[model samples]
Target chain A: MNIEQINIKKSIQIYDELTKGRIINRHIYSSSTHSLIDNPLFQELRENLDIYTNQYQMSGHELIDDGEYFYLIYKKLESSTNQLIKTKVYSAIIVLVRCVTHLQARLYESIKNVNYGIEIKEINEIELPEEYLLILEKAKLGTLDKAVEYLADRSFLIKTNRDKYVLSNAGLSIVDEIVERQNG
Target chain B: MINYKSTIKYIVDYDEPFASLVEYMDQHSVTRVPVVFFELQVKQLIDKITKGTDRQIIDAISKAYALRNLKQHNFVTHDESNESIALTKFIEMFVRNMSEKMRVKPITDKRFKAHASQLTNILNEANSYVSKTTNDKANFREYLQDFLSEVKQDFESNKRAITLRTDNLSKLLKSSEAHGDQRLIYTKIVELCERYVEPFFQFISHTQDKNGFIPTMVRLREFFAEQEMLDEEAEVGRFILNFSSYTKDIQHVYDRINDYRRKGQQDLIVFNGFEKAFNHLSEIVMGMQDGLLVRNDLHNNQDFIESYKRFDNIKADNEKHGNVSINYTDLIEHFKNIEKDLVFSSRRSSQNSPLTQEINLERLALDKESASLLRARNQKNKQLILKISKLIKLHFSSFTKLEEPMDIIGDIHKILSAHMDDYRPFFTLYAYTNIRKKLLAIEKQGRIRVCVGYDQRKTFAYNGISYKYRPILIQDLT
Candidate 1:
């Protein structure tokens, strides 16, 4: 196949992955995992990034690249779905804070290191305040484990083991932004 | 004769009863112990000390009283009636000094004025001693020493009081219980600063008031320096140094309180922001649950935007990447071909294929005939409705002229029979029953007033079926 055909094939593949709601991170260890930034397909799409972005836009999906990660958002979001996403994000952050506070750990430091795994047992032991628990329950994340699983599914957390999970770079970036805003 | 010193020694040796007594007096801030109450306490103590005979307990009680009344021991003195025993001033001071438990009372303005007056009198006395003899100088030095000691003690106690108060307030402010009520914690901090800490700091550090505690101490230090009494000067210097240190300690506590207040304000702002976001999201969820097509303006709401920005790492500024324009006209056929391929693929995967089905002409003709018949029935029903409406209107027009309440069913039957050459009573009755149902519904909707009564004695027969007759009176309030 010619280079143009190869590029189009790679672009379609990357676009398909993004539309499936999988975050494309800069680093991926295994070649078996084809969605990594280092994949030849990703390199081909990067060479024609603007073309692919415009192509995705024509399809009613906005391609978002924050330098380190890539994701997609619909150009016109349904209001209910948007609100539900916001609620889930807020609930996750609030639960994260409560867990950090219960463990008597610094909020930013706890989430900054990708290798820093929070024990699932310790998270289950945390007794969140009633008000915070109510919010989580309303968002269908009534338990800390469920909230952790939700974040992991969204690529905000990485499940390192059956009982341990570490904050992903995307999650760390969010925490860093929040802390900076609070301190500032 | 009891050796008074040994008696005092004996009282101290039984640390249980005597120590317990001292603690009770200190905590209650009472110097006088009633005789009976004292005996009762001693008896209780003895019972605990030894499960001995009653006589032995009585002896322990007697010894306690004897120790209190010892003339030479002077531990306590009895009143004229001997009903109560008061600790001697010397013993009271000793206990207070030993315990180091000073009552935490903020120094009053009145007391500060008294100190200033006392210092002035001493300074005046020193100034009047012209051609001072050694005896006069000794007396002046003694007086200065006494005044400096008292000032030192007062300052020490005041420092202790401020430390204790601030420490308690700090613990409470940091406690989880206090977090449950942010407003209460805020009020407590404000009250501490306004009522106690600020005032005490001002009273000590008020340089504007020449007779203030700080200025008076400086004046005394200078007075001793003028006399060239090296020892007295050194003592006063040390006093001033101690005073400065105490003020610094209080200032440290004041800074801590300020920090807590600032932190509390920040926490409150954060808490309120989260609460607002949570409430707004909850309202949206509730609206959606109620089947409302709620517009979530959260993305555009300033407060919600601020909250979202805290958690949103992805910046929406996509202008840096150069925009690439595509010619949609050129790709239209290509997109249509891709769409057709997708549709074809999906169709191939299904169990049944739409293209394989054959159309049945016979079924089409039958459907057309049935549709025409249904249309005819609908048209007939519509005409029946119009006739029923006209008859009801006629009945209402002549309502006052008619003697008997209108038999709505009979009237509808009569109208149907007169209007059509061939009319089925069953169908007419069905139409009348439908009219009655509509009228009841209108009444329920509050568009009209209606009263329905059953006349059980009367039966209405339609097609060999009997239904009890019901008469309704409807008032059209509208």
Candidate 2:
């Protein structure tokens, strides 16, 4: 019922109307109908249906029927379970930033006010997860030599070249500050 | 009443050898026997067989006792010391006294008459043979003279026949000359055969007949067969080998005539009759060239000749007109004129203006109208070519075999006409080359002089060298 939801529903409605009220033919739902369904439009409709939930935008016109549309929505929800982790990771980065800023603010305010008896309690710890070490090791940041290196070693990326790096275990945990805060 | 001694008895009492061998028994003075006389007496005994009688009868009598049945004569069983006497007695009783008049009757039927006639024929034949054999020298001389005379006569007759043959051959040749050079050469060869080779062989045949070396009847039939043109080729061959030497004669005559022709003498001359049939024959032959038939058929019947003469009475009329020339020339000229007139008349229809003529002119106009159709078609073709060229120029492409458009409608006829002209030259050239090549190859392989194309010289190293002419073809424009 917000603008975002309204746009999504209107977009889907337009797509359905352009496709003559059917986004995918009913024939595509059955395994037996796969070979018989050869229209190039069917493939476009399939790709657009994947983007409908994942990217919130369709690439082409498609006329998918009710059953296929419902199944595609169900599959999108199932696949979007990974999106929850991604969302958690993003919120954790914000949380870490907030924790750092809050600590700095406290120090500055106390100093500016010049209060003699102002005492700070211990700042809450933003402990990175133990699994972060595994991610860092797997990334192989030792021999990276590109501006956007995937952090693997290869001959084209000599060790003496301009350096590049992937996040360490601690950095990875700190970058996920906003994600961790959202999850907590 | 026939006495026993004369009863058709075979005489054995005077058997010399037996008598001589036993004669010593009768003599008191015993002389040693002469083996020579004994042998001579034995020889004489064997020689005393009856003439004009079957030898079997006499042989049976000589070995009489050996043939006697032992069962029938018991007393005369076997005698060793006097075997000759035994044989003598057996012969005297059984064979010497026999007569057969009572058994078989005398053969006095028509067979006797036949036998008499046969005998007479044999005697006459014998007499003739004897006369021929005994005085054979004189008879042989006479026969030789007669043979020589007959040969001479035959030679004369052959000369006459040969003359006739030559005349006929010459006529044929002359006629063939009128026809074509090839036929003339062939006929001239035949003429030469008639004149020279046939006469000599005819002399040989006549001599063979007269000498009885060849039967007269056979020679006569042979001569008749050779002369009989109606006879089949094989039957004619059975007679005196009819070696025509015609080819040689034809060649000789051809050479002579060719020599004359090369010398540019008159093409034809008078050969027979007062008016000279040669010129007429030549003219007729010329007219009959290329297998044309000529019917000149002069007849001996005066009536027909008289009527023909009347029909042909232009001579006197021409003479009166002071033309004084042979009417035959005029006749030929007139005939030629008629032919020319016919040819000209046929061509006149196209040459003359159809409008001026009595025939339908509308058809001609229609034809001319239709004829413009091709001109329009040609214009359309030219336009199409120009358009296609302009369109194709942008592509920088020239025509290819496939891309070129053809008038498929009349292409078959066009191709036919084109191939007719194109193939003819090649056909002629190829035919000439093939025949020339074959002939030249044959010549090179040892055949002597053979004429070939237009005076080309070729040498053949074979048994004997010969020369031949290579004739040239004259250009004909028609």
Candidate 3:
């Protein structure tokens, strides 16, 4: 293949990553994964993803530039076969994030500006719904551990320590999307 | 028998008019009918619902019964007419309670009786203030200061008592599942609820002069009774809401006290921010008596009062992002609600200072840790699909049927399903289309010659059984 052809291939590879619900933070991914932060090929994809893929009919998936990271938001359709998240797991995650935020804001101890990474011990202090009992039991790493890990695995949260995870921008965006769905 | 809230909800659910055609119905109910008798009733319910109920309930009921369907419909339904009749029948009961022998049923839940009586006592004391007939009219500012001091004293004394009781009650609620003590949990819930719910009467009783405080007190009463109707299982949500609501009040009291002690302007800027929102709401609601009801989402969402409970006494411009970020939609809504204060309910400042504008909004930023996590997930998901696609290719390579397309993918699906047991995220049954879509795109680009075709067919086993499936074939796209 010619150099231009190879660049086009690289762009598709980048598109594939986003299509799977993964976020491409240019600053990090350029260094860690592709080393293509300023590379013409990756930059081309970053700048013009929708233009090339507009013909492919991406099942209502759109490339969203939330200004922090790049990812695909699947506009959820009732009959569309893309079933990525379970409702119970989603609810548990939202509840966990709320608990962490509520505790940090309310408790505000001697330490200031500590990352809102919640330990299972701290997570246990907040009240959650009864239906969550089943979800916790289904979690392989015990309820709280599995709960955080599931979000981390989905790129919704990032594991900071053995006991704590921080919600990612992607996670917050997903939650924002969930709330919009709920509102509509 | 008299759930005043339920009756009002019944009318508003149906009667609130939509766009234009039947818009007169919104006014006609109060102007033309006996429904005006319950004008005070509807106003109280609208307050309780928007400001007092859980966000989940508010969101659910509002969306399910939004004002869209009432465009051409009459304001009152047959059921509401029935409810209106029932409401009139109960006027004597509401009045009789004001006098000695109201003749209501004694609460069967013994847990609530103590707190209920305490509420009655506070009500009696505050009610006497209205009848005091002072020679000189009490200054509103002086009156509020005195009431605050009393409330602060009351809170300080009961802080530990309420904490200890609620702590024990929540523990009982958690353990009730394993211990099978449903009744025990129920009573504890009632007791915990009563401890938090009754103090509002003290505010409502004396704060008749304080703008918007009495209406809030009325909503708290309805919210408390609403809590009473919930079973032990469902009451957990209400239980958390009660604690949140109380803590919000305590936080406000603390902030106001701090402001008063600071002895600066003590302009009651933040306090009156809330006061004005409430004052404005009361004016709009009171206007409903004139049969001029211009409906909108009411002001002073109680959630906002609770949210900035600490910052409420300070200048609005100084409001800042403290420590953590709330990711949910409600947080966004809470910030938007900063507009409802009606104190600085002015045009948005070009600078958008937290103080001068409605919401001191911050754009959520992705941290390095989160960014790295997302990048790693992308690489991993890519690798997963690549490996699964190879396995699928190898399975399809043993294609013996060159005569026509064969139903080979179904058996491949069963094999992939078992092989991808640990691959929960990647290998979903629903993603058969996703996998196929990717494979076809690759084929169209000539990167791979993998073939996928589809057909719905009635199937027959070689021996006896027959079934149907959305059958498909796989081969090299040669």
Candidate that scores best on TM-score? 1
Considering the two chains of model 2, state its CAPRI-style docking category: incorrect
Tens digit of lDDT per residue, candidate 1, span B290-390? 44344433332334345554223222213323211223464686666555545555333323332333335588799999999999999988986676667
User: lDDT by residue for model 2 over B421-441, one digit each (tens)?
Assistant: 332222323333434444445
Model 1 ranges with Cα > 4 A deviation: A1-82, A99-118, A125-134, A140-142, A149-184, B1-44, B52-147, B154-216, B225-234, B238-478
What lDDT tens digits, residue by residue, belong to model 3 across residues B251-369?
A: 45434333322321111122223233333333433433354333221122232223221112111111224311213375676566565543355445534334444433332244656
Q: Tell me the spans in candidate 2 whose CA falls farther than 4 Å from its real position.
A: A1-184, B1-134, B175-178, B181-191, B194-478
TM-score of candidate 2 on Cα atoms, chains taken together: 0.13
Candidate 2 lDDT over residue span A71-125, tens digit each: 1222222222122212222222222222222322221112112121112122213
Q: What total of clashing residue pairs does each candidate reach?
A: 0, 30, 2
Candidate 3 ranges beyond 4 A from true positions: A1-16, A25-45, A51-69, A73-78, A81-89, A101-114, A120-129, A135-142, A161-163, A175-184, B1-478
Candidate 3 chain B weakest lDDT stretch, 10 residues: B309-318
Better of 1 and 3 by TM-score: 1
What clash count does candidate 2 reach?
A: 30
Backbone clashes in model 1, listed as residue pairs:
none
C-alpha lDDT values of all predictions: 0.58, 0.32, 0.41
Every model's TM-score: 0.39, 0.13, 0.23
Q: What's the DockQ for every one of the candidates?
A: 0.10, 0.00, 0.02
lDDT of 1 at B310: 28
Give each candidate's fraction of reference contacts reproduced. Answer: 0.01, 0.00, 0.00
